[model samples]
Target chain A: MNLKAIWWKLFCVLLLIYVAIAGLLSPVPRLNILNETIRNLYFHVPMWFGQIIIFTVSLVYSILYLLDTNQKNASSIANSKRDIAAHSAVTIGMLYGTLGLLTGMIWGNFTWGTPWSSDPKLNCTAIGMLIYLAYFVLRSSFTDIDKRARFAAIYNVFCYVMFVVLIFVIPRMREFSIHPGNGGNPGFATYDLDSAMRLVFYPAVIGWSLLAVWIWTILVKYREIKLFWNMRMNNPLSAVALDQV
Target chain B: MQAIITLIKKEATIEWRNRSVLGSLLLYTVLTVFLIFFSFRNLDPLSWATLFWIVMIFSSVDAIAKSFMQESQERWFYYYTLFTPGQLILAKLAYNLVLMVLVSTFTLLLFSLFVGFPIHDIGFFALALLGGVVCLTVLFTFMSVIAAKAGKNTALVTILSLPIAIPLLAVIINFTKKTLVVQNAVIYSTDIVLLCSINLLMIIMGYILFQFTWKE
Candidate 1:
């Protein structure tokens, strides 16, 4: 493997290992209620940062897919890959998002005394999950590859815009939520960071986001190979000729 | 502009020709509201706002989902040669807006008639309704096109539109709830601006994105 190509992967691995060890053992502010669970900031918060990073990457790929379609000399293979990238990114992003939700729920149970509350951020995450689930369903309903790719890209773009608006709009509607950084409560940045947590928090965010992209690359490659295998199976002669080559 | 108007006129004439379709939509609204009236008998202002928006969302989906589906492919092919996709979508959006206005007004009247209108500031409520209708119409109209293109899976329309419509519906519901009483009336200008900006964004997005969907 190329040293240059694998630097970030190595960084991601090192940072995450450091986080796992240092997160549990590190001293945190002995605040009431939060107490030891304040350490969740290292894990739970990074899931959202990772999810948003990957989702933004996915949205960009979707836009590129749409834009590439307009050019007369555009390569269909590249366009298809863009669609696949967008799809895979969404899959991984959703995985991170679900993890974020579950982690938040577990933390909320211990802290807020319930598995879930009607917090704006929580509701937004739930709705955001639904929108992406619909994207997958919409993709599945179409039979033609090109048509499915195009339509899914369109929905991906539209859904991203709305998801972002929901993220901003919902919290503003209700002035108070139990979540940090919203309504009266000071965000983690102000009250909780305290330099030591920031050491782990920033690295954890970067590490998790890099890990998401790494997983996304693996997913894209798997899907691409699956597509290639399907194409070959449909044409045994092509498979035989390619095997000879 | 003239082309858009003509296309909207064409939509109106088609809806007028199938009068039963419009009547059935109204009947759907009335029956749903009647069901709620029977079940609840009395609703608090919050529930009233919520239920009203729920009915509006579903009925709007039912009404607008067919906007693209009702037209035959041959007619679309013909229009494809005549008008741009942007013109066609804008026209459909305008027509759906008008249709939703009628449906929402009818639903509001039925709610008042059955459960007693609780809205104190009627004029402000109208503004919120218009805002909700415009956003819902814009988003659903585009989603319907995507649904129609993807083999006209009409159920896909609701699944696709409802989640995206959450923000708009949330703001409108909150805004309308405030209008239910004269004393708690704090009509935040930010919400109104949010709705307007969202409407503008949806319109621009629909116009741009429909071209890709229209191409194939």
Candidate 2:
């Protein structure tokens, strides 16, 4: 196999092993300290952290796209770069968001007495996900390629802003929260997250983020290949130009 | 000044001309108020206040989501406007805020009449209504831009809007309870401050972000 394929396989194996070890072994004697429920933090906190990192990357690309559109560049190079960034961010953001929701649901099932409740934090996350889902639907509604990209970038930026307000600001203001730390629940403020918890939590976040970037790179390559094929099929002469790159 | 007023007037006129939009908004508002009254025919004042704000929140979503959809349908005209996005948003917010206040007033009046609850602090109730209307208008304006771009109808808008609206809804309900039932200001000072802060934050954030999403 090619060197690139070998590297990707190795990376996947390493990631799987790391996640398993961290998830299964790290919460050991601490289980006696905080109970079996503390185990959920291994998955839940990292998913939320990964989501924020991906969304921050998405916003940067969106701002870059707006700036690029106003500047002069080789049309193909500019479009390709912007498309890669935009598509990668969306894919990774969706993954992080999905995992975050799942992990939170799992954590909730044990901690909050039900898998899901209308807690303010939980509700805000649901809304944030819907906003992003609408971003995808908005892209699909437009037939023209350029219009779709432009509109999607604009909507993506809006979603990011709304995400900040809904998730960060709104929940803190309310007096009725089932989530820890707000509204009368004795939260993280009281219980010190031990050094042991931090060890696994930090690495889990880094590992998940790196995994996101690794997957994003593969997806970008796939997109480039697909675009190249489309260009070739549409005009055989253009195929030579792409192949040279 | 004149140009802004003209834009506001033009938007208001267009909104009025869309008879179906206004008609539905009015009908929905009236129906929701009546439903709340019917559902809690014998509930206490606190329950009545809670049900009233819940209905208002949903009604606000219904009316505001359509605010931009009508303009989006005629893309060419919307894009050809001389005003910047900030101006357009301002106009939309002003128009919607007026409509929302009127709707809230009508709903509350009908609610008071049918439910036969004693309103303890008239001034606090008015303040609560004003705060609720401001919060709803700013939040809905932002959501309208999102819904306009999303192009999914009512369900999508609700999913997008309901969460953002919660803090405001909570404050409104709490304020109403304090005003219409408890008749105490000292109990809800913090809630009032939080509601005002949310309104301020939403307006500033919505203004800053409007141009990004308003692009044609």
Candidate 3:
């Protein structure tokens, strides 16, 4: 790949390496309770940021797929491409969300004295994850590629709207949350002590988000290549046109 | 408007002709409430509220699971020619709302008779129940359409809708619990606002998206 095409990928790698080194060895506030564990902010919180970015990408592609289908000049191949892109983004978003949950559990174990609690944030996250899991189940039940892609895109849009509502409503309804900045607890932002943490924290979020998008693009390309190869194996002549795509 | 009303009436006539489905659902509610009654002769308000919502969720799922699959393909084609997808979905949603309202009323009556009636604020209870019913019916109606298209049974419908319904369920359950167990706790308008907005969102989404699912 040329430098222009791979510049963001290079940026993601370099930034992540810096984060890994500085996140651990960099000077942090010496607090009474969260002396060392505060470094989790660098790793754990960025997963959610990355997940949200990828999930938004998935939602946009799903919407595009629907809008494209409604057009009179819609092509089958382009429609399928949008569907594949949306699915790949969701699959990667799920990975980021799972990592966030795992990292959160470990942090909660040390600080909250339990891996899981009745905290609204925790429950809402779990429910959001389940919604996407059901999306996969819904997709797998279909055998026809066109039907699966169309219905999955429709379901994707539906669930994303509901999930956004859930995230918006749940935290406001409850008066208490063990998570920071909700209810009465101090937010992680306050613990920055100085501008030192924000320097690492903001880059960590951006780097992880870019890394997620990069993986999603790779997955989309892989699927397209596989589709092309299968087409070539079936009919040698038809394969020439798909090469342009 | 007229088409939606006619479609709703058609649905009611079909449901009326097949009374066994409604009967079985009522029986299921009774059996569930009785099982809970026998297991715990006396219960506190918290358990009462918890078990009540549990029954509400399951029974609603059972009742609305058949909304789309009960019709034949030929009948759907016939209806498709006569009415637009928006009209068809609106009618189904309205009919399911009525059916769920009846089922929930019966369930609530059974709970009051079997377990002690813990809810003192009838107005608040009714408001919460209405929100819950609207949320469940709109959501399940759309989901049953998807499940039927997949050519699967009620299990697929349950798996698909239940997870997405959790947040609405959580809000309703929390509101009901407040009405039942807490004293001097005012009814929170924000909760009602949240429920109303969620219901509106789902109904609008279902109306717009049903056309995509209805396509053959």
Best by DockQ: 1
Chain B only, TM-score of each candidate = 0.95, 0.90, 0.95
lDDT digits (tens) for residues B93-165 of candidate 2: 8888888988888777777787775668887778888988898888777767766666645666676566556
Candidate 3 TM-score, C-alpha based: 0.94
Clashes of 1: 0
lDDT of 1 at B129: 93
Indicate whether candidate 2 or candidate 3 has the larger DockQ. Answer: 3
- Per-candidate total of colliding backbone pairs: 0, 0, 0
Query: What TM-score, computed on C-alpha atoms, does each candidate reach?
Result: 0.94, 0.80, 0.94
Winner of 1 and 2 under TM-score = 1
Error of 2 at B27 (Å): 2.1
How do the residues B139-169 of candidate 1 rate in per-residue lDDT, one tens digit apiece?
Answer: 8899999899888888999999888888778
DockQ of 2: 0.28
Top lDDT prediction, candidate number: 1
Please write out the lDDT profile of model 3 over residues B23-75, one tens digit for every residue: 99999999999999999989888788778878987898888888888888898
Error of 3 at A168 (Å): 1.1
Model 1 scores what on Cα lDDT?
0.86
Candidate 2 structure quality by residue, lDDT tens digits, A1-245: 35255675566557656766876776544333346777677677777777778778878877787666545552445666575678677878888889888888877877667888887777767766766776676666656565556556766775576557545554344558877677887665345455665666666667777677667667777777777777688998763466532
Candidate 1 wrongly placed segments (more than 4 Å)? A1-4, A73-75, A170-174, A189-194, A236-245, B183-188
lDDT score of residue B197 within candidate 2: 80
